[model samples]
Target: MTFSHDGLRDSLTMLAAPPYFYENLRRELATAERNRSRFTLIRFQLFPRDEQASLASEESQYELAILSFAEVLKTSVRAEDLCARLGRFEFTVILKAPSAVAESLTSRVVTSWSSHQEWSKTALCKSAIVTAKIGESSLEILNRLDNQELIGITQS
Candidate 1:
């Protein structure tokens, strides 16, 4: 199921919140199906890969890490692309490029975040990049990502 933000913005990442993310996903799916073009939907999740997970302040640190990661995302993609906070620790990026470009973009983003001192000190961020399949719906894609399964063709 999806959620509604109404007037509330995603305070941390400053990206479009859940409901809007679903809306954009729907539109992108339709456009991809119509044009028979390839696009990518990437899911990023920030989780502690080390002892940081034992900290009581891990939640706030995750927020800060995500905020910094969002900045990385904004700089990595074109202005026309969409980035949204689909859940507390999950973000989704819509890339209008082909599979190769999308994979490159994802790799670039991962590299950028990995090089950042703050993120490196905070948590390990995992990402999955996948292409949108023809006739696939937005909800199905999201469900697949939530389950850690590749929805369309797995590009990563």
Candidate 2:
């Protein structure tokens, strides 16, 4: 019944960092390959659009927004969904759903942030939702999402 420190750490939460995200993503892709099911990859970028706030304050504000947003995401999605903090201003969610469902979820998230007072201060939030393609590598999907060239729901 004993567990190592790493085991305890691994058991903590579904949310993951870049390294773990990449590893888990690889496994998830493999599972999708075997099951012949698709998953949606959604990326969220939260930032403050106000120029009045100093860079330091803006960063701190964004940090708070990120935390709040992460909580919302964790609560909103199903337990099987994977969430990750990809960077300081970026987050990725892996959902076992179609792109339409992912789009609906993305829209809901953006709308929820608008009404949430804490997220109001961090005005600019954007989300891109795309379905995982068959025979596509995890890196390719992540790289595509990272491009930010894809149009997504954005609220100021």
Candidate 3:
């Protein structure tokens, strides 16, 4: 689930928002499969997980938070990589070629972001990786993410 806006909330199936999210996930999955790299959907667990979650006072503040999230994400990831809002705070990143290399890169990104000022303040993010099999597609990656077995792969 991706965190929603400036609040500690998420859209489970990404059913409530625009179709862009699914589109982004689908694109990232395609890229991952093609490059033979691992695609990890890092979902930042936001607070106030309820629908009636308190909305940030103004859209401006919300935008700042979103930008801040992006900043941290960029610093954590590679410039050639794709880090997008798959759902609110849920971002889908297609690690560049080589699964091992990608995994290492993601580790550093996660480690750095976890201690970043933004995350330290409680606006949280969690990560999980889904590797592509010979015939797997993006949807498969999405399904794999729901597998509880992968929970807490890397989080402090």
Candidate 4:
């Protein structure tokens, strides 16, 4: 991927925010150089089912659910990966591995979630993976098994 002088200049001249953004970007670029073939976007979700009204009354259940999800994330990926907290009920993970890696991560995530749910006396978790774009970056071949709502984890 050859970058013409002008294109390279434009990318490098990002107005200016702070040195931190550039430093962080440089670090990410260095890491990308080491493993460039794969990138994944994992949407970790924790949707409380409306049907599970029993869980509604149990604040501790929600706490357990959050803790369980934290366990899954902590156990699921490498130390260098990025995990974004998108919402109270969701997370987005970015990994250095390829698309197949993402698909496998999804499976591991769901499997681990299922095991945790079983321990918590709840139903299995639902999950999905999808392709995301970051301009010239490459993409991976992944099977996105999201929820009925396409947020991962199906519910009635």
lDDT of 3 at 71: 63
TM-score of each candidate structure, all chains considered together: 0.82, 0.80, 0.57, 0.58
> What residue pairs clash in candidate 3, if any at all?
8-47, 44-125
Residues 17-134 of candidate 1: C-alpha lDDT, one tens digit per residue: 8777777789989998999987888887776657635423556766667778889888998988888877766778888887688778877887788788767566666777777889
- Model 1 misplaced stretches (Cα beyond 4 Å): 1-8, 51-56, 147-156
Off by over 4 Å in 2: 1-14, 52-56, 148-156
- lDDT for 135 (candidate 2): 80
lDDT of 4 at 96: 67
When summed lDDT is taken over every stretch of 10 residues in candidate 2, the lowest stretch is 1-10
What lDDT does each candidate get?
Answer: 0.74, 0.71, 0.52, 0.51
- Tens digit per residue, CA lDDT, model 4, 1-156: 111223212121211122332343345545555655445556666654556464446666665575577667768888877654434445556666667888788777777776664433443355556544343222122223233234344322
Writing each residue's lDDT as its tens digit, candidate 2 over 1-156 gives 111123212222335667777877888889888889999999987655677864246455655666677777787788888787766656788899999998888888777777687675555667877788778899888887877554445455
| Comparing 1 and 2 on TM-score, the stronger one | 1
lDDT of 3 by residue, 1-156 (tens): 135532221233322233544665566666656776555454443332234544253445444555555666667676665555655545555554455765676567656655655543444445666555545765676677656243222355
